[model samples]
Target: MTATNLLPRNRRPADGPSPGSARTKRRRRPGLMLTLGLTGLGLLVVLAVVAPWIWGDRAEELGPSVHLGSSGEHWLGTDALGRDIFARTMVATRLTLELSALATLIASTVGITLGTLIWVSGPRIRAVGLRVIDVMISYPAVILALAIAAILDPGPKACVIAIGAAGSPSFARLTANLAASVAGRDFVGSARLLGVGPLRLMRRHILPNIAEPLLVLLSVSYAHTLMALSGLSFLGLGVQLPDYDWGQLLAGGLQSLYTNPVEAVGPAVAIVLAGLSASFVGDGLAAAANRSRRADAPAKATKPAEANAAAAVGTAPAVPDDAVLVVDDLRVLRKDGTALVDGVSFHIGAAEIVGVVGESGSGKSLTAMAAARLLPGGLHATARTAELRHPDSAALDLVAPGAENAETRRRLAVEIGIVYQDPSASFNPALKLGGQLTETLRVHLKASRREAREQAIEQLDFVRLTDPASRLRQYPHELSGGMRQRAMIAAALLTRPRLIIADEPTTALDVTVQAEVLRLLRAANERDGTAMLFISHDIAVVGDLCDRVLVMYAGRLVEELTAEDVREGRARHPYTQALLAATPRLDTAAAAPAESAGGPEASAGEPASAEPVRTLAAIPGRPPQPDERPPGCAFAPRCPQVLAACHDTPPPVHSPAPGLSVLCHLEQAGARTGETGTDKPLEAAR
Candidate 1:
């Protein structure tokens, strides 16, 4: 059930596909239904356009014999007026098609506007709009059409108006739901963080993503409107004298069904065929769109920078003294006052890579997001100081209410860049790589298209992506995971911001790709002097890439130490020690000494008393949820060296050495008593 058990099972992969199994996923051609649907609609449109011209005169001609049965000259019999039923049916196509098309257009326009209104409105307005739509939808489409038609004169115009109005509610409801779903995606959130205005965001991101579904809905609405219009005409409220549709022909034929059934049968066949054409098109388009989206998505299913100068403890500095971002006492809380990130603060100096290492739900990502003012709705952040300091200008207060004006946000857009974990999800699927890459440049930097494109290519090349020009033309799904991440990095560095908040940017990558990403991040920092807040649960990665490492536990900073200190086993907090032990190393088995009569003997070339090989250790118990955290120390229940006081009282910050701070009761006492905390391991101290 665990990964270990599953790993060995997949050791020897299948040499090839089993007899019936496919080796490669076959790309399906357009569905037969889609082809048939398009073909049927094409034939219908041709009939609508040319049938009236070819059969108009003959259809209105009075035959010598009325209600005649099928014959060589007059097929499917004649109507009471002695007109050819087949000719009449063919001629009715023009009127029926035009009315349906016009009505569908009207429904789509009104529905889309109302849907957008509901989507972007405040809660009260949205609620009211939805209620009205629900009430309108409660009545059957035909019933609504009848009521509207009765209010107006009985004619084609009234029928069109009635059907279109009746169908708007369904379209509106579909559009609103689709828009809401698309708006919740991460790409939309990323665009918002980049300071894209609401209208632009909706147009460029939201509407485009929902466009295909709306198109499918358009076809369906056409079909529904066509049926409703036909019903109205059958009831004598549509296509009055001198104009005839399939419904009018059906109405007249029904009165003489017993005399000559062909009159009723012919018109009924035409109506069914026309309705089927629209329904088939809608269903086929929907299927094609779904397949295309599936193909565009992966084959497999699956922030602002804040600067705070003050460290976790007074004696130890989490960031360099010359900090670019200084956030003090940052707290991100839910609407109900639950603290997700409580009193957590850190800073990043220019060109420094400060890594935040912690287990999931430790508020690592939340802290970075809060500082950038990118927290999700219903969660607000407050900080005593979230100041972005530049050498040339006064510090900008990022946390102050009403301070984030258009100018401030525009400045932040240029000053802070965020690299998200899943690059594919962060990039807009509906847009080409080049457009998304150049958007920030055009919007925030006021660069022309040519200039933005030039800069985008340069940045893409800087991130070591090959064929940068060609990649620009491709969509996000067209690139490999590593390539997409590189493109994301390029986008982040395109504006050459002062700070980059990489929230586990390399978490989803393979080891080799992860190394490449880390290298690129380091190179960017060294070359551009762009500070970064790198967040990851991988301690080894943090040690490899960061100048300083911050260990967060639960929702607070449990320890702050230099990457060197962490590498040298000088971490004072028990959580940090456990994290270090959990990191898998190739040398773990090699360093393990052999068992002997006396005890475990040191391996050859090792000291007489070799240290025990540390097997990977999982920290027992999951991190507490925000509301479930203990009143005292959040990690007290899980800490190995927990003292009695740790259950009732919070641990005090301890400065064991310069540039090293931890929150632990033992360390605090040791610091106060002038004890050298690093002389013994955490277990020995306990």
Candidate 2:
């Protein structure tokens, strides 16, 4: 997708700014330093354009008295050649700024282009490029420029080239590192998996995300370039004789320093002022960028009554069909044909919350991404059927041949929203929260600026975000983790899509914020009947919020049970039982031994050796890797109740109770006879 799809256009309405827009600008006003820096830069540019024309004649005219000190007639005295020192300094502004500006442009263009190319290239090329940058930067920029200047004829053109080439290595190194960091972010990966072209991805996502740091670096480079050019001119290798700069003026004044001290002071002061101007501008831009990184403070903590009031909902809106999403025999395979997610099948009904629970690397998120056709590059997904049904369109088979075209992807985007695990990485750091949130409305619904803003505010308020309108002016980094997640929820629900694939959405949040997010999600589902494919590793969280839970281990589903079944100790799989046992309990008093009910006095009579020592339960061993999985059940090695037959044979899926499926040898064996195996009792822990 193009940036215009998410960013606001510059079109002005005949009716003027919308009510929301009229109240506040898209972003807050620039800080005092930024304003001052901009003002100084503007003034310098004006002087560069007009100074030579206004003072050229006077600067060339010989004064009656040579080597004159500061006086009423001569503010900065006269040089040895009887030229006006102040006029000469003023006249040199154009040439000085011209050389530096051109040099900066060359450095930025070459450096940024090389750095971006390095980031996008293969590992070998990137390694070579990084080494090249290091080698170039090892030489001091001024020394390198001096060598280049000595090789070329002394002139302005040569000076610009030398300085520009000397400055490029630093820019290149910084750009490469910045681009690499941004390219691996979740948002960038999402855009790529969604079929955004490489060029568009770089332009719309990577560049914008990295622009702030590049801008600050550019300003600093310009200042350095100006200094380098001035030094070259002072050494008689730049600007030549006729075309003078501050450096040449200083050169001439230094010859008669004792007699005409003010002459050198004039040029020296001008150079210092110019350098200060660039420094101020760079500092200002850096401060602004830092503010973007440290976004607005989080909203006040949510009160219990307020949370309850916000979560309250009436009857849920009726959905068009029962099942919002359905997948059968789903598999996500790497290019080498190793299955990351193998044979995962499930369905989500209207307004139902289906949680996929697993340990790390168990393919919980892979399955969800496969269902949405958002698997990363180098990985392809296939299934017998992967169908998505939205109220706005007919059913779409995401895994069907030629189903990944622009139109199909657009439809998929409109129908499904994804809430990624890291809220910070889910957004474009350069864009405001409002623009990113309202992008769906503007692109999919063709909403007007005013309409989108109003609806965005409403959604933000619904998610319990305080100062909803003000938040529209803030950037992503300005908010706290909880606030950003809430905004992310608002962004997802803005279009009211049929399904929201929340991939571990609450993993980064603290307990209090996690609870609030769960409430908000539950409320959204209840009010809109939106189906959710909630993916998380936290069994307690899944058990609390989900209607049905699918437990996965080592790229395969091991068990399926209802929320009540998970809570009431009815899980049939050994892996699921182990996960339950590993969960820590909060109520120590309740879990305390019955013998200790009379406290220390009652326990005093008992032998100290008879006292029970409690320890937190933990599962032994780790889940198997995808490619290195055992021949039979993937979890067989980790299963505590592993049998000899289980080592050589894959377990068959068996339904011992209504709506419960277990992939276990015991379950399969139980189905052969009248006996049904008993599941270990589990405590209901939140």
Q: Name the best candidate (by lDDT).
A: 1
Give per-residue lDDT, candidate 1, residue 138: 92
- lDDT value, residue 627 of candidate 1: 65
lDDT of each: 0.78, 0.77
**Model 1, 359-408: lDDT tens per residue?**
99898999998877777655688887788888888888877776757778
**Residue 448, candidate 2: how far off, in angstroms?**
4.1
Residue 569 local lDDT, model 1: 62
Taking all chains together, each candidate's TM-score versus the true structure is 0.85, 0.69
Q: Write the per-residue lDDT of candidate 2 for residues 495-569, one digit (tens) a residue.
A: 888898899998897666777788888899998889999988778778888999999987887788898887664
Going through the candidates in the order shown, the clash numbers are 7, 3
